[model samples]
Target: MRFVRESGLYPDVPVPEVYAWNTTFENPARAPYVLMEFIKGKAFNLVVRDDDPGLLSGLCAVPESQQVALVKAMARLKASLSKPVPFTEIGSLVVDSSGTFSVGPLMAIYGVSLGSPYKSIEDFWRASHEQRLLEKIPNFCARTEESFQPSERFTPHDLMDRYQKLSALIPYFKIPEPYTPLVLHHPDLALRNIFFDEESLLSDDPKVACVIDWSGAQILPLMLASCIRIFRGHRYTGIVVIK
Candidate 1:
């Protein structure tokens, strides 16, 4: 949050001010928590809706003008975030004891239980593929003590063989030059995570006031980071291509 703020890329997008936080469960809260500024605004998802006025609301009902405006706002945010920071290692950003920030071991979800920082993208992907083949595949294939039947069409051995072949190809899969740099990416940048004033929808310029839920934010390769999954299945006129 501090890095993005200091970059002055998308000044309009306000990141919640973290008053306090505990990354571990050792604290009284007994869970990782961040005490941040309470942002007051309407979520983008609820703001856009169809004409039916039913319980379900989405972008289906939104005006073309509003859709373009909102998409522009989202694009601006993504463009600013795509700017590369000075990170030599691939891992989650962390604060040190001396109040310095740097890349640390990757968080458990992305790595093998807080895996060490990777020097190269190839190393990162290789380790990831290996983890899936060696650890996760075996665990999933393991037969439970209770009588159990395999629901999958392919047998456990077939799955293992497929993964083994896939893993062997990891070394040959090269990343493009442009996507070599690592950049910070929000794990989820969907409309539900964005907040804006209700009034913005009324005008040509729709500004996003706040972008919350920074959990699981990562320093990822540019190619992977550039994707916003929400827009994948969207079918609308004048669909702006982001790239």
Candidate 2:
């Protein structure tokens, strides 16, 4: 929310203010929560149906000018987030005791129980590719054995060969440079997560009151940081291509 406000993406709009946060709980079952300002606005999806053109025609009764304005607003927001930010390492950001921010392990931000963070993008890509193969090969072998009788089954040597072949291809995979500039991005920026005044729908220039759900927001690679929802129909190559 502070990033959005500091970027000046939505002028005259109020961003939700956070008073406090509690990440600790005495009870294991009880989860942590954030205390923040209450925003009064309907979800953008409730007013506009950009994801569904069929429903958009009937459910989205707003004027064409308003639709154009909404698109422009979204584009401006994307542009604001695309600005480059410097980082010495290729990992998640963390604040230390000295009140200074630095790049830390990715697992620090995405829970330590999940997996360890990589020091370079190539290492991360190689680990991900190998992990996927490790998971799929076992499942594929089980499915193949179950679908056929004993007489049609392949030998253990054949299965090992298949696994070896897949593993050998990992080195040839192309990985992006580890030092790519990180950009601020909201990984989940769907219309359902956006908030706007109900009355704003009637105006020719509708402004987004707030964009909620910043749990997945991060500064990452340009390719990985691009908004999936906004670029569903197109590819984001770190260059703005208006069509």
Candidate 3:
């Protein structure tokens, strides 16, 4: 209320004014909710699906221009903040509005990022010889194994012991560095979620009118965000870089 109202976002009145928190207290009491202006526009998914080609359509092909814009948008979204929102707040973790099942649904119980290699998520992971970051990773892995069924926890020291024991039996067994801290990933930048404008190539509203449903958003690193682009649907081409 204070920021949007006081902040000069519009002329005298914003498009849809935030009246009385989120609701009106005319006669009956109302529940509290945040309010913002509503702008009429097509969902980016519809425009992107028809405009050119979306990342959603794998192998179908989208223009490099559109793809670039999507990346830029992702970059902006990813770079906009410094602190990481709770995993639940990130858009990717939310239930999909389109009835599309999310990878998050499966991993939500584990408190592990899906990008966490399957091995790291496995039961009884070898600590030292298998892990790249030796010590820093063990505690993190152990944290997950504590409650995760079918998985064994390994502290850094435990991992080292496991690695030493496994060295004699396995060939080239190495768990890579943690992907969590390495990259800022927008894990759920899907095509169905983006909107575009006529003037803007892929983005009809280049100014980021309003980013709806951010349950899947993550803040790992640029590489992770870009790599997730690989999994985007045909309609999505990552952020489309117009300017």
Candidate 4:
């Protein structure tokens, strides 16, 4: 929220000001609670349906000038939100007692068993692959093992072959090298999180009122930073014949 405010990417938008917070979970009565400024505006999702084709049909329904302005504003926000990572590590950002920012494990913030942060993207990939194969697969198999016949069991060789195939794709996808620049990405950019002034939406100059829900934002490789869910409507045409 501070980053968005400081960037001034959306001048018309208003981010709620946090007045206080309590993270103590030892007592049920003292559980975490965040007191923030109340923002009044309808969610953008109310106007645009997620299943709408081209993701532009709703916008196109408005005046041509408003449509153009909204598109331009969205593009500018995307560019402004992306920033280069200062460190070479792949992890969540943390501020130490000395008041210095540094990279730390995702577990610190999410409290999951994701383990520590990696020094390189390759390390992150390797650890993630291992975790999925070793931990997730086994846990899933255990729950459904009784339903499968003995011959249908997933053998060690099966897992190895799958791992090898995924490993080979690393180079094909062109995963970034160590110390490569990363950008802070909001994985979920659904329309519901965006707020706009309804009056201005159809005016000559459309203005975004605010964008909320910054949870799970992380600095990651540019290749993985693209908003996949939001860009699903965009299509690329190409053909590659692999002999």
Candidate 5:
């Protein structure tokens, strides 16, 4: 928490106050987590109302220029990290660009538990559980395919069995790889996770003020694109395009 807050590209960007943190512990049994000033923000859920309507309005209004700036910010965050961060000690510091994945931590926090923490960052195995979602990749694909409408582009089985094809998707999504060589992303960077003074906080140029919720971050391109499609809107100006 301190490293990022102290050395980020936006050290001067006036983000939410990360003043309170307790990253140290005498007991090894306790899980390590840092707490900051819980940002006062609204989520982009429950549909946009007539007043603000939806995030689409905010999404469309963001100029292409701001997108570039946000992308640069993310890049800076990635660049600041040291390389080869061990898998076990990965706190919020994000030292490994490639290991920066979203699934394990996200599922754990939200009570969803998507699969488990496996060898592959993109793939999850039981973090420390006996029961996992998939015994192998084929099973994983079959399971994932069940959620989406059937399509010819690929099948659930293909996803499980084919590793090379899935790896190729990293570039197409323009997702950043931090923590492991994959990508650096604000996994929880959504409207609900943001914090600001008020609606007037956007008088200059309303956008996602300070992205919070670092649950599902990392360098999964397909998943990143999925998030952009679902969370980003007219007001979203910080996404980095691959081109």
Candidate 6:
């Protein structure tokens, strides 16, 4: 959020102030930790009733007006960040000794291992599927073979074959030159991660005070980053992108 704050795009929106942080396990905290500002605001989910059944009508418990305001606020944030920051490669953001920001090695899964920074979208996509086929599938198969029924368990060969097929289709999914620039993408932008003033729900325009939990954010191609994510009952329906 240092990046967002420095951009000067969201004057009304405020990210937490980091008092201190240790990114290493050697710290007294015993694990990596950040001491940040505690903003007083309600999460987006808190504005609605838990038992409300409005979702069945294709609307969430939030009133239609509030929903519109929420979308507007979030869209502005998304658009603002999408512009100011642009990277040549796809990777996690990193700060160097001189406090200069750059794209760094990507954490494929919970930082289990850092993959080389990808200079192109094709490289990133290819490495992702290759890793899944070569490592993830084999690891999963070995871990689950003893507990799961044979019919239910996926063989490493079968899973790898499926991944290989998906990998082969990468060319067809390529974005044109216009939308290929790398932009930051928040891996999780659920309502729970968005905060606003409770009183703002009564107004026609509710401002998002903060957006938290940006752990796995990455710089991705605009065609992938600009995709809209729909929220179903309690889960995200994944990103939907239009050419």
TM-score of each model, in listed order: 0.78, 0.62, 0.36, 0.66, 0.37, 0.74
Give residue 62's error in model 5 in angstroms.
13
lDDT of 6 by residue, 28-145 (tens): 8899988888888877655545476433322365566655666666677677557546567778877766667788888543665447588877787788778766666546755655
> Over the stretch 1-243, how does candidate 2's per-residue lDDT look in tens digits?
544454554454356876655556854547687677898887655554567654533213555555555655566566656667655444555445554655555542345421324555567666665665566667556664446566855655566776678667766654466526566666567656777777874465666777776653565666676544633443223433333
Q: Candidate 1, after superposition: displacement of residue 145 in Å? A: 17
Show where candidate 6 strays beyond 4 Å: 7-13, 47-59, 84-86, 108-114, 136-169, 227-231, 234-243
Superposed by TM-score, candidate 3 places the C-alpha of residue 67 at a distance from the truth, in angstroms, of: 2.8
Q: Is candidate 4 or candidate 6 better by lDDT?
A: 6
Winning model by TM-score: 1
Model 4 per-residue lDDT at 15: 70
Residue-level lDDT tens digits of model 3 in 47-131: 5455556533432444665555555654554444323333321112322445332223222223443333222223113332344
Estimate candidate 2's alpha-carbon lDDT, on a 0 to 1 scale. 0.58
Q: What does the lDDT read for residue 163 in candidate 1?
A: 84
> Distance (Å) between predicted and true CA of 72, model 4?
5.1
lDDT of each: 0.71, 0.58, 0.40, 0.59, 0.41, 0.68
- Give me the candidate number with maximum lDDT: 1
Name the 10 consecutive residues with the lowest summed lDDT in model 1.
Answer: 48-57
**What does candidate 4's lDDT look like per residue over 1-243, in tens digits?**
554454444344457776655456765566876677777665544665447744544443556555556555555555555557566666665555554656677442245545556776767777777777776465456554356567765755567788989987764555646425676666566556667677765565556667776655566776666553323453323231211
Task: Say which prediction, candidate 1 or candidate 6, comes out ahead on lDDT.
Answer: 1
Mind sharing the TM-score for model 5?
0.37
How would you encode candidate 5's per-residue C-alpha lDDT over 1-243 as one tens digit per residue? 333355453343235555443334754536555556665544334325466654434433444554454344333333333233224322222334443423243233353544433444334322322233234444444454457665556665554445445445533533244323323345554445544445633333333445565544443322332333223433444445432
Candidate 3: TM-score?
0.36
RMSD in order of candidates: 4.2, 6.5, 13.1, 7.3, 10.1, 5.6
